[model samples]
Target: MTRPIAKPANVKARTRRRQVSPSLLRAALVLALAASCAFAVPVVLGALRPAQSADGAGLPPVQVALSGLAAGACMSLSPSGSNAGKTVFIDPGHGGMDPGVVGTVGGRQVLEKEVTLGVGTRLAELLRADGYRVVLSRMADSSVTKLSATDSVAGAMTASAVHRDLVTRTLCANSVDASVLVSLHFDAFDDPAVGGTETFYDAARKFAAENKRLAVDLQ
Candidate 1:
C-alpha cells in the first residue's frame, strides 16, 4: 500500500512542456530521469518514449531533496591501499526479491539489482586488490527478506543483515576492524522522471562525514 507522493514544484521544470508532441515530450522527460539516480526515490529514464513501467508496479515518488543521509544508504570507499585486513562491508543495495529501480538506459530497460551487482563486483575486486576484507550482503542475487510491514530502513537492514551475517560467520568472523558498510542501490521516483547518484548513512552516526567523504571521492 506504499506509494510516492508528488512534489508539484517538480512539474515546474517544464515551462513550454505543452509545446512538444506527446511522444517527443516523453522522450525528453525520460532523458532527464536517466541522468540522475539518488534521492529519497528516483525515477530514471533514457532516450526513449514514456519510461515503461515494469510489471505494472513502479518506483517511489520524488520529494524535495533531503540534504540528509537515507537509511539503507549504499556507501563506497576507494581502497586506501592501506587498511589491509580491515573488514569493510560492501553492501550491494538491492537484491533478488527486490529489483530496486526499473529504468531504461539507451532505450533498453535495466534493472537496479543487476546494476548494483555489477558495480558491487568491481568494488569488491578493488577492495580485494587493496587487501581489505570485503563482505558482501549477498554474493548472488536474492530477494530482500522483509521483517514487517513497517517498511522502514530496518526492513532493508534486516534483509541485508540476513545476508551479511551469514558471510560474517562463514568468512570474516563477525567483526569489522575499521569496518565500513557500503550499500548500493539505484534510484526510483514516482513520476518516472527523476534520477541521480547519491550516497547516504545514518545522519545520527557520529562518522557520517567519513561516509560522505568516501561517496564524494567516488564522484
Candidate 2:
C-alpha cells in the first residue's frame, strides 16, 4: 500500500492565501455586465434619434428620459474610480476605400462607415467613462491597417486587402486582451422598407454559447 505524503505547514499556508480579492472580483463582474448593456445603447440611439441631429428636440419625453437613464447607467461602477483591469474593443465596420451601405438621408448621403464610427466613438467614450480601457480599431475614417500597393484596385479594396483589414481588427482586440468586443454596423437592403436591428456571434468559437447569450442580450 502506498502512503500519501503530507504537505509542509508553510506550503499549506501559502495554498490557503487568496490570490484574488473579493472586491476586485465584484468589480470585474459589474464591469462585465455593464459592457453587455453598452451594446444596446447605440442601437436604441440610432433608432430613436435622427442622424446628424444632436439635440433632444423632436424626441418624445419618454425617449429623452430613457436616454438620460442610459447615460447614467454607463457611468463608472468601480469604487476606486477605475476599472480593476478590464478592456473593451470597439470595431467600427467599413471605412476608407469601402464605404459600406451608402444611402441618402435628408437629401444628403449617409454612409454606414460614418454611422458606425460615430456610434463606436460614443460607445468608447461611455466605456472609458465607466472606467474601462477602450481600444478602437480605427479612430478616423480610415482602414485599420495600412493599404499596400495591390490593396486597392481601381479605388476598391481587393479580397486580400479586405482579409488583412479584418484580421488587423481581430489582432487589435487580442493585443489588448479585451474582455469584450463590440463591432458596430448598420443593416442595409436594396428595398427601402426593410428596417430592424440584429446581433450576431460566431458559432465556431470556443465561447459560442456565451457569444450567443451576448448577441441575444444585445438584440
Candidate 3:
C-alpha cells in the first residue's frame, strides 16, 4: 500500500523481534514450574519423613560409684588443687535448735542431726584436699547455730528452723554471680538400723559436670 513507507527497521530486525517472543515464553514457563515446585516441596518432604515413636530412644542408664572418697553429709572436692577453681556450698542438714531424729539402740542413742554435721565436716576436709573452696552452712552445733535459724522471721516457722537457716545460709553464700550450692542431707527413717548412701545434683542448673563427676568419684 503506499510502498509501506521506507521501513525504519528492515527484515532482519523484524526476525530478531520474533525470536524474542519464544525466549520470553520459555522464561515464563520456567518461573511457573518453579512456583509449582516450591508449593510441592514441603508436602513431598513431609511425606518422606520417618514416623517417630511417642517415646524416643532413651540414653544408657548410669550407676554411681564412690569408692575412695570419704562419707559425711557429703564429701567435698579439693579446693586447693583440682578444686581451686570451684566454689562449693556444703550444708549440714540439722543443727542446734533442730536435733533431728533421735535413734535408740540396745543402750546407745545416736542423733541424726548431730551426726550429719560431723560427716559433712569430714567431707569438706576431703574436698579441700583436692583444691575446692569449701564453705559450711554452720561451723558448729551450739546456741549460735540456733541464732542463725531464728534470726530471720517471727517464732512462727516450719518443722526445723535450724535446717531452714542452713539452707538459707547456703543459698546466700553461693548466690555469687556464678556459684554452685551443694546442700548435704543425711537420710532418716523410723527404723534406726536402716542405712545406706545417696547423692544428688542438678547438672543442668549449676553447669555442674564437675560436681557430678566428684559425686560419682566419692560414691
| Residue-wise C-alpha lDDT for candidate 1, range 1-219, written one tens digit per residue | 111222334432331212332222222122111111112112121121112222111222221111221322222222434545454555555565455555565777676678777877777767756756454545556532323344336345454554543343223212222256565655544444543333333444455555455555543
Model 2 per-residue lDDT tens digits across residues 29-50: 1001111212222222223322
Error of 2 at 199 (Å): 0.6
Arrange candidates by lDDT, descending. Answer: 2, 1, 3
lDDT of 3 by residue, 125-171 (tens): 67656655554555566322234444545543354654545445533
TM-score of 1: 0.47
Task: Give me candidate 3's TM-score against the actual structure.
Answer: 0.47
Q: Please rank every candidate by TM-score, starting with the best.
A: 2, 1, 3
Clashing pairs in 2: none
Predictions: Cα RMSD each: 16.7, 20.5, 34.6
| TM-scores for every candidate against the unseen true structure | 0.47, 0.62, 0.47
Best by lDDT: 2
Tell me the TM-score of model 2.
0.62
> Quick one: RMSD of model 1?
16.7
- lDDT over C-alpha atoms for residue 131 of model 2: 61
